[model samples]
Target: MQKFPAVLSVALLLAGCAMSSTQFDATREALRGSPPLRQQAIADCTANQARRSLQARQDAARVMNVSVRAMPRTICTRLVAGWSSGRLSYDDYRSAMVGSMTPNTVRIIQGR
Candidate 1:
């Protein structure tokens, strides 16, 4: 049926939205350990985030894509706190990190 194509397309789009392994590893490393370690990780994360965001932006432009305009600076206090305090599991935190940094999420935040 015609609906099959639409359903499959939606599935593929969602699957493509996952964060890459490099981002996952960096975040995992940053989430654990002492305050000083976290501080250093935050610095590294922000720098990497900026570079990756720029590359993503340029790639999207080249592809004439509108789905993801950017990757926000993902190192934030709330995420760190949640992860540090065990309020959020590593997987959940990773999902939240990706969700929070989406272009749509940024739009919502800015509008509020």
Candidate 2:
């Protein structure tokens, strides 16, 4: 029949559209499942938070002329590294930095 080609073309067009939509959705879901950019974004956010906290402690210590105890482990190792590098005394460092070690800081030091 003369109508057969028209029907076939229309069906093919519809099928192509369906396939395109499915592909787009699949791509989106795949990206959502394990997005590297999002993972990196979270990591960056965590690092920035740690940096700000450490800075806040340093600033506070400067104002008080005494470092506070119980810093996050990440901050503590950084502080300890500073001490080991001759930036601070072992005794004074211990006094200034006790209880400041957070688990996250420890993890950071351990290369986690």
Q: Which candidate is the best by lDDT?
A: 1
Candidate 1 lDDT, 21-46, residue by residue in tens: 56545445565657876565445443
- Residues 1-112 of candidate 2: C-alpha lDDT, one tens digit per residue: 1111111122112122323434534433443465573344334433432444455645433432444332333333333333233332333322223324334333333334
* Positional deviation of residue 33's Cα in model 1 after best superposition, in angstroms: 5.6
How close is each model in CA RMSD to the real structure? 10.8, 26.7
Q: How many backbone clashes does candidate 2 have?
A: 7
lDDT at position 51, candidate 2: 45
Worst 10 residues of 1 by lDDT: 1-10
After superposition, candidate 1 runs with Cα above 4 Å error: 1-33, 54-74, 93-112
RMSD of 1: 10.8
